[model samples]
Target: MSALRTTGLRAATGVAASALALAAFAVAPASAADTTQASVQGQSQQTAAKTQQAKKQRVFKVRTEKQLRMAVRKANKTSGKDRIVLLRSIKFATGKNSKGGAGRGDLDVRGSLVVMGRGKSINAKGVDRVFDVRTGSRLVIKRLRLRNGAPAETESGGLIRSRGDVQVRKSSLLESTVTGAGASGGAVMNDGGMLRIVESRVRRNSSERAGGGIEASGGTTVIARSRLTGNTTGAVPGNGGALHLTGTGSVKVKGSLVANNTAGAEGGGLWNSATGDFTVERTTIRDNTAAGAEADQGGGGLYNDGGVLTVRASNIETNSATGAAGSGGGVLNNLGTLALSTTEVQGNSAPRAGGGIEANGGTTTVVASTIEGNSTGAAPGNGGGLHLTGAGKVTVDTTKVLANTAVEGGGLWNAAAGTMTITGSTISGNTASGAAADQGGGGVYSDGTTSITSTTIDANKATGAAGSGGGALNNLGSLAISGSAITNNAANRAGGGIEANVGSTKVMLTTLQGNNAGTAPGNGGGLHLTGAGKVEVGQSKVHDNTAVEGGGLWNSATGTMTVTDTHLRGNVATGAAADQGGGAIYDDGGALTVSGSTIENNKATGAAGSGGGVLSLGGTLELNGTNLNGNSAPRAGGAIEVNAGTADLADVNAVDNATGAAPGNGGALHITGAGTVTWANGRIAGNSATNEGGGLWNSATGTLTATGITFEANTAPEGPDAYNDGGVMTVNGAVILPGSGI
Candidate 1:
């Protein structure tokens, strides 16, 4: 039991008066008063008598390493638990040629051994095990320095190996080297035992195989308020520069700094691989690296395989991996369950994948943490900050993924049938560049199923030589986007804002605004859906978006688009000799329905363009309570142009539309196909044209009907010689108007 725990127990036991007195005695410094001096004199006389009796019984102090070892061996051989072995400031010299040759020099302690430094140092040379404790012994090392001054090639085992419980408090382990063909802990190694280390420092340590600083296998180790830094693994394929844990062990680390540690293979700072559980709280893992030749593996800061790794209130930053296929510059979770809360992973770089975290065949959950400013360099990486692959499940709640860059997915990349759910989080300002000919996603690329709810996807850029979409979020599987905003995203090619390909996706109650798809020969400005997928957008707004063909939304072949209560407005298409059509919306070969929407103030200006507001090439458009107004087209259909499609307009209004052309015809609506255009209980008024047909121009043998509506104040060219027509009636419209036209 710890003294702090004992104090807490005594305080909890209702000895309040005695506990308060002890607290006052422990807190206040001893002062000399006349009455207190008399009481202190009386206590000093009793303490002198007890000291004389204690000196007469047995007072043995071991000062040398050989003397300390002999005393511990004698205590283990002769005495029981009642004996006390005292080691005070014992200098143990350890090297290849010092004291004796490197063998197992064990000091087994069966009784209680108190190795006290008393603000002094202890040097050990060529000592394999400074102290070994049996199952019933209690070894306490306080305020001691176990220094191992050996060459890099020599083999030095742990300073202390304990099978029983070991308590190391306020100690420092320095200048230790575990050479080639040997695994050494600079301070101690606990196998099937319990080790408690508090306020200790483990520095300048090197190991050949594993655990350069401390190795604990099949034990329970608790390290609090300690520092493990400047440790390295010297041999090839070595791991765990600062600490290593294997077997069925459990380790808890709190308020410690694990930094500047280097490993040859994996886990530059800490590694846990064997059926154990590691819990790290309020710890900092930074500035660590793993550099070698053959298969230098994951986690520049920490790596865990087949373990339960839980980290809370920690910081993992400025770590790196330098192998060919290095993963998880900060943390790597392979077949482990890693749960992190209130942690920060920033400024980490990986050569291969997952600059911040890489999880393969594991479960990772991050809540209220931040994974930002991480980068993966010129490699075929998947995710810049987080990579979730191999059937892993990643859940992020209220976390932030920002300013991370990768080749495939800038913020988060999910492949190989993994599941990622981001709720109330943000994925912003991430960049992805294509290496050769492949396109990358700016914010997120999900090759599997991904769900995002109540999140924000903004300001992400995907740029390269063959870069198509700057803000391209490519989805190959099921993508469900609800209650989110995708705004200010840029792309170089088609589907600038978003491209949903070969997926079953739905965007509901979302907003897509102010996105620019760069000048490329493609369609779908705000969103493009293709490859036999289905997209349903409900109660959303897609406005102020621009593309070459489709300004607000563009639908390609083979998809179902159902939009309700949406708005598509203030979009422009500008390109030289561009096939600029559908300033607000364009549907190529899909089933599109626009109901209760306002698609207005859109311009599609080009040499021979059409459909300033909406263009439906080959789809079924059912418009209900929609307003398509103030739209301008240079060629035809100031508000809408339909070719090879059926448009059913009910309770719709197409007003204040203009068409500018040498031989302008359609002002509000144009139907030039074998399609049917029916206007039931609607109005097409205040529309202007340069030539004729202020309301509509139906030319390609289509049926046009207007019932229970008015075409009032619609003006053509104002002159008898200017071919002005259709003040109240346009071309071939059956109107039932009760009032006269203006």
Candidate 2:
């Protein structure tokens, strides 16, 4: 029995082992199936969650106007952020509005919503605005074209009226208008909202008042990579044809364009009355116009009134202010602060003043900028490049003012109440063509207090009958020029380089070279002083100047001139008349003084020229420690001449003086017409005359007094040392050296 039981147990054990193996193989297949079922169930749950989230997101696709209205109403009812996607272009009719609600008039937005247009268009049919955002709502518009929207007769913003935060991206606003007596913002009006425009265009918009394209009040407006063009204001008086801001918020334009806009009053492109900052960077303002005829209406490009305006790396070009009394064709700072850096203002025109920029009663600063190719209109036009008037402080540093034209002040004009400082600048290729007697300044005109340092005024012309100061003119003010060069300037009348009239002018360490004055009959090639002014030149050089009367300097009856440590060289006087020649100086009824100065290589070449070095006609001429060398004249006075005046010489040297004409007299000194010449401790050497006195000549109405005088190497046909033709002569301690016959 034990043996049978053992056999059964062995069989059972074997069977149990086979069963366990079968169970293991089956368990693998069952677990694989269960894992597959669990994965499938998880995927189903995920799909259902995603579907529920999408339903809560609230996305609407609209094709017709009714669908769009329903989508907007549903978006307003939704809690979270909603999106309305436009499937096709939609046109809105002239619908009636019971009140300003969400589902009706203008598609009012009352919640955070995004309207995506997918390159489609929305037409308003010239009836009402396209969008009106409520106070607390947030609206975002993208890839849409909004056109032909006309707001109500009493409202602004034909396209959008936002009182909340709004953003527009890659969109266009075109042919929108607002028509009322005081309506504004033909395209968009942001009232106490944050308006952000990116890569959008606003074009061909019109408004009855201001802001033909955009108006922002008490909000922040930012435009980036956008364009505003072909906008127009009403025919009445308004400001800002493209953009107007009058609020306490800031406005910023970056990498944008504002062009081809027109205004009836001021600021054809942009007007900032915000009291906050208005900043422009890397933008362009071009081909804008202001058509007002009033004195306070101007600024074809930009106007800043009681605001802060900062422009950097921008261009303001081809703008016009076509009013009878308008100014600032490019930019106007009226009672505000303006700063321009690394910008260009070119090809601008104005009727009254400030063709490129105007600063009136404000602080203005320009650094590393170029103001070029600007012009002003006829007769009373002034300040082609920059005009500073009405009590302001202006600073121009490292700037170029070039190729400007005007009646007066071709480059810059500073009025009597303005204070200007120019440093490291260039004023070149400017022209002033006014025929009036009180107009001229090819480079600059200053009736205010002006200071110029390390500047160059070159290649300027004053091509008028009575124009003066080819380089600069200062009248009724104080002008100080230091370390500057005034070269290659031409004037039709007086002062080819500078004119100081009824003012106080000081020039120190400056150069006046290659200047020409008086194509017909004028004087003062380098410097002219008139109208009871005081002019002081110290440590300066005047060379290569040509004029009819005074090649180097001319001082009028009431002018006072003082020259100290200055050099006058290579000056020519081409007058043919007997009393109209002074190669170095012509002092006619003035107080002229030259101390420690050098006058050399001056020539008076004509038939009846006189005074190659110095001429005094009814004035007081004083020369102390001065040298006159290589001076020649055609007739009378190669070095010094006194015709109806008094000349006093102390420690003066007259060397190598010659009279080249036939019957010439006075190689070193000439006195005639009731004049007096006094010499004390002076030397006259190597003087030659063609006919009469080689060292001294006294006429019948002249008087000559000499004390301690040395005469050496004088040659003439008669009286090599001294000649008196029935005149009074008193010589004391006269040392006549060899090669002279007295």
Candidate 3:
């Protein structure tokens, strides 16, 4: 032939060597939009080859175990990779010889085989397994039912055992049992092989040790659209009633259900260990129980040890850890990482701590999740919703923590040096109640550093005689809160919002409102500070707080308290008077500084009440660039009652302070006991009194030194502006209005 004719003929026939070389260049080229042009043609050729392979496929029909074994052996001798075994009703009976699904007693595949059952089932009748894959073999089984395969005397895998690889679809494994020494995997066991299950059921299985449904080791397993129900593992110290994985294997479960499973130790549904990784999506794990006898056993739904677990769009509900000291009813994460997105954990319970989740030593992250309706069973149990400890970091973003109950920390407890961050979350409607004392923090308890931002904590309660109550938080470590709201919390004793013990607190751009402390006599309705704890408030609000003493704040610390750009208003101090009443603040032995703040519209309404704004007792109180106005008292010192303290007031406003309709003294400034009050460059105006000393009153043993002070429009029935009775008062550079002096 001519050369031109030869080239044209080679191009016409697509199997030419030069044409195939050009096909490689056209496959997945960069800078090309028609990406699948060569791949589509190549796939067509591969499909033609597969069609030819299908011509070699053969089918065998069997009705008994002996016939199935002969067929499998014949298929292995001939076309082992392309043979199908069709099953009918095989009523395999119980035999006297004790051989469990091995050698010639079962349908053992020595090579690749396909099992297809068209409306047929296999009744093992407590004899042997229906299908078993040997070493170096592959199996595919579909549309089948396997039942009543019970193995005895330390042998595992009552129904199916795979030493190679398997792919199962639309099948059922039911009523299987493995009871002996260390017997496990009542339904299926994969030993160093890959497994894939689709649209299958594993039910009513029991194991003497672990994994009542499935167990996998040293391989990869994937299960989708499957169901596992009514399975149990042992009666004591057995784990993973549904599934278990060990060694360096991994599992992924999607669109599955694991329900009504029970375990005696931990992981009633699933367990993963030995550096395995697990991922679950769109699944449900519900109504499981872990009923151990003693402590250190938990995880009614799932557990991970020394591994990583990730879940998305899942639900864990109605699980329980019913032992004496069990914990983590929903999930137990020990030395592992847990990441959840859009998950819900509800109606779970534990006997000890962490009714919803417990994390130890590894990081846990929750994004847009809900944790609700969980509870710790009784006393000596804390953290009803969640617990974290031991050098782990927990991050919760846009989550809801609600309606949980415990002895302490009804919502969450971060204990022993863990770090936690909550952002854009809501924690509400939680209750903390113990039998007696030593219970507090209805919302959260932190023994480490806690950071909160843009969060809401409301409608929480801490009752039953807490020693020093913290209805929202009891912080023993550093706490930082910004752009948050703390409202409608109640405490039985004190500190309805926050209590800081031996830690520092920093709050900025936050609100503390509508909180109550104690029924009749309490302290620090908004906040309390004791021990070596310090507080700093900037750009914050403390309002509508009710207490018996220190309605807004109480500081009994020897440390420093700094307030800047803050507001304290609409607070009340009520009930009897023995040392009770400071409508805004009661300072006791602290270096207190207030600057750029407003203290207004507060009241001290008790009998013999004092200091409508502040009661200074043995502290260094300094006010700079502050406003104290419109405060009312029933008895004495409508604005400030100095019992025993030293105060320096500079650039401050003491205005509209009144002792309305009461026989009291010092509508603006009053000093009793051994204390010195020094006022510099301030305005004290529009004060009214029903009895004596409308503006300034100085008693015996009280010293007043005034400079650049102004007193205007103050009225009284007895003293108009100033009443000095046997007290040392020295005034310099003072400005008195024309009709405002006494």
Question: Against the true structure, what is each candidate's TM-score?
Answer: 0.83, 0.90, 0.88
Q: How do the residues 1-742 of candidate 3 rate in per-residue lDDT, one tens digit apiece?
A: 0011111123444457555333221111121212343244646766656544443444555655555555566556544353444445666754722454333445667677777766567777877655677888888878887788775557777787788888888988888887887778788887778888899998999888888888776588888999988888996458888888877898998999999998878888888784989988899999888876454567888877768889889998889888898888888777798998899999888888888887776888888999898888773677788877578888888999998888877888887688989899998987777534346677777778888899998877777575344455646688888999988887777777776665888889999888877752477788777666788888999998888777888777475678889999988877456245778887766778889999999888898777788877778888899999999788777888777678888988889998755458889877777678888888889987777778877767777777777888988886667666556666564433222336
Instruction: Give candidate 1's error at residue 53 in angstroms.
Output: 15
Give the clash count for each candidate: 15, 0, 0
List the lowest-lDDT window of 10 residues for candidate 2: 1-10
Evaluated against the true structure, the overall lDDT of model 1 is 0.72
lDDT of 1 at 355: 86
lDDT of 2: 0.85
Scored by TM-score, the top model is 2
Model 2 Cα RMSD, Å?
12.7
lDDT against the true structure, per candidate, is 0.72, 0.85, 0.76
Off by over 4 Å in 2: 1-56, 94-100, 732-741
Which ranking of candidates, highest lDDT first? 2, 3, 1
Model 2, 567-608: lDDT tens digits are 999998888888878898888789999999999989887688
Candidate 3 regions with alpha-carbon error over 4 angstroms: 1-56, 78-87, 94-103, 235-237, 293-296, 435-438, 467-471, 557-559, 733-741
Ranking by TM-score: 2, 3, 1
